[model samples]
Target: MSTTTQEAFWSGEFGKAYSDRNNWTSAQYDDFYRHEWGITKTQMNEDCLRDLPKDAKILEVGCNIGLQLRCLQEMGFTNLYGIELQHYAVEKAKEIVKNVNIIQGSGFDIPFKDSYFDVVVTNGVLIHIAPDDLPRIMSEMVRCSKKYVWGFEYFASSLVNINYRGNEGFLWKADYSKIFQENFHQLQEIYRKMYPYVSASQQGNMDYMYLLEKQ
Candidate 1:
């Protein structure tokens, strides 16, 4: 399995399969949104929208099934946009959040203009991006956000190499503060313990949230 194979696997059949398994019903999403992220729809809305101005523009990367869109709307966020690569997930998101501006696109190349969004948020999306492509993806995220960018992801203490048959890949154990410091002047770091049920086998593993502001 080469880089091309990994990309093809994710963009082609794997996307459909994941979306089919995860996005087909509201209940499926409710469980995932709550337990996985440690937040209910109501809580997510409050956290994302807190201290922001009225009608703030928000862009969510990899907004699967629009769970965050619905949450934001419920909390009175009017200007909401999302970018997703999976077509099935995009369709499901559209169906779920009829009013949001959801576009089918890759995170590596966001279709939005620079400094267009007030707040950009991504949950559990960055880990899937290949390590070699991370710099471009991070640059794109920083380019689009005008005020703040927040991310929730799994990070390890050391680089992890994942090998599947002939395919070999690796993910850098992201130094949250270090990464943001390179690009943003003001940054805050928060660590959270992920629930065991989400990855029962990975017992001591944890997730982190990084909130960044462009200086």
Candidate 2:
């Protein structure tokens, strides 16, 4: 089977091992929930989220274990869906977040009709995509969303590569928002913010959150 490097890395034994290590205990639940909650608050204020139709569909790409979708569901968004590349993660997400739909899939080809969702979003996902293949991933995301696209990823003013767990090509930081605007002529920037570097181990790491609306 022809697979991208990502699919090969995240779908085998190593992927299963990563999945096994991905669960959260009760002790860590509060922090995780709070983090996602804060993002929802920001999304609401920036994207006119409160004014969206009650049943507006939202899909989170790379939604591992459904933390973001769970937050949306808890925050009263009626239609929530997530697509994950890891089967173990998808199973866990479905078991835990029973109210939301979780599917095992990839970003290269989102298995949904064009404009099927009101918003297509991803948290820390785009940075992993190889730049040569980024346009395909970005187009697939925007194609699935009827009105908006949201992204939260490590951001830099220019493209920068970082070693992740000793892996050379997996992680990167870049001006993702600018990439968005450049790729789509009608995309209007609604919000952009660089979060403070907070992780103890990755001291210099910073994340950016962006919400863009299509005109």
- Per-residue error for 61 in candidate 2, Å, reads 1.0
Candidate 1 error regions (>4 Å): 1-7, 24-30, 33-45, 162-173, 183-200
TM-score of each: 0.78, 0.86
Tens-place lDDT digits, model 2, residues 1-215: 21589667777766677656756643355455235443333343335455666678999998878766765676677898899998888998887686788888998889999999999998878888887778888999989999989887887889998887888887788988789889987788887776655445556656777888999
Identify the candidate with maximal lDDT.
Answer: 2
Give the distance in Å from residue 21's predicted Cα in candidate 2 to where it truly belongs: 2.9
| Candidate 2 accuracy as lDDT | 0.77
**Pairs that collide, model 2:** none
Q: Score candidate 2 by TM-score against the native.
A: 0.86
Error of 2 at 102 (Å): 1.5
Q: Write the per-residue lDDT of candidate 1 for residues 29-123, one digit (tens) a residue.
A: 55665675555545544554467775989899878778767767766778999988777788888888878899988777888899999878887
Q: For residue 163, what is the lDDT in candidate 2?
A: 84
Query: Which candidate ranks first by TM-score, i.e. highest?
Result: 2
lDDT of 2 at 40: 35
